[model samples]
Target: MQNLTTKLLAAAALVAVAGCAKKAPEQLPPPPPTETTPAPETSQPTGPVGSTVVPGSKEDFLQQVGSDRVLFATDQYDLSGEARATLDSQAAWLAKYPNVRITIEGHADERGTREYNLALGDRRANSAKNYLATKIDAGRISTVSYGKERPEVAGSDEGAWAQNRRAVTVVITGM
Candidate 1:
């Protein structure tokens, strides 16, 4: 009888405690999509000249320039030869569309302190911006550093890290 009463009291207490817990809303929103397209292994321009690329559009930039991003070495913000080539293509494309404005987003791998990564990302962004500024008007290009907060690939492995460490030029205006 005593054990039964103790069990009942415990059960009642548990029920009371559970009742106080905030109930989740019945209609929770769906989670946001996370799928992302991987960048191509090569940066060579693949779009046919005078192709059906919409002028001053993001799609046009990607199709015309082959890549809007340039990968960087770990802990290094300097543009690689391949990166420069890609940037050169980008510059040529930009020259064709003088009304376009771009924002270079700098990203870092998920391997450093937030503050350090932010600074590194900033340097990477500036590197791309400076390179582009030489050909395009300095006022037409802007930069932003996402640091490690935005990873191109979600993993702790080297391959993922390599992809995440990059500066991506985004066509923000003149679309």
Candidate 2:
């Protein structure tokens, strides 16, 4: 009789405690679609472009640290003094934040054959990547050539051409 009473009392106490606990709301996940794309990501960090402060959860903190860094004339990938100035700032920012990795996207203006533009883009991106690696850790950077396939600004004028002839540094997430 005593053991029965004790078990009943413990069960009642457990029920009471459970009742007081807050319940997590059930989440309704997004519906499945005909096509699957990467989950939409919000720009969680609108902080200053070069700010060293990591934003949000370490997992959600990917930032576009460097934007469109410059490339050069019709047939050159060497880092010009002007281009070096742009990369100098990029390198400084990377050094400021230790746990970041990046990809350098090289692009070219639409003035050449596809293969030629692709090669040009590679040269452009590698130039910027090399410059950054010199000032920061080499392991933090990777380079890819998008050539003329991707353009920061689209058009045929010198203004658009200038924008396209460039290397863009993209901050990779989940560092």
Off by over 4 Å in 2: 1-68
TM-score of each prediction: 0.69, 0.62
Task: Tell me the deviation in Å of residue 51 in model 2.
Answer: 11
lDDT of candidates 1 onward, in order:
0.85, 0.74
Stretches of model 1 off by over 4 angstroms after superposition: 1-53
Worst 10 residues of 2 by lDDT: 56-65
Candidate 2 yields a Cα-based lDDT of: 0.74
| RMSD to the hidden true structure, all candidates | 11.2, 13.0
Candidate 1 has what TM-score? Answer: 0.69
Candidate 1 lDDT tens digits, 1-175 = 9999999999999999999999889999997654223233233344576565446667767867869999999999998999999999999888876767789999999998999999999999999999989988989898999999999999989999999999999987432
Q: On residues 1-175, what C-alpha lDDT tens digit does candidate 2 reach at each position?
A: 9999999999999999999998887987786663222233344444666655444222222343343467688767888887888788667556655666778898899889999999999988888887888899888789999888988787999999887888887766542
Span of 10 residues, lowest total lDDT, candidate 1 = 35-44
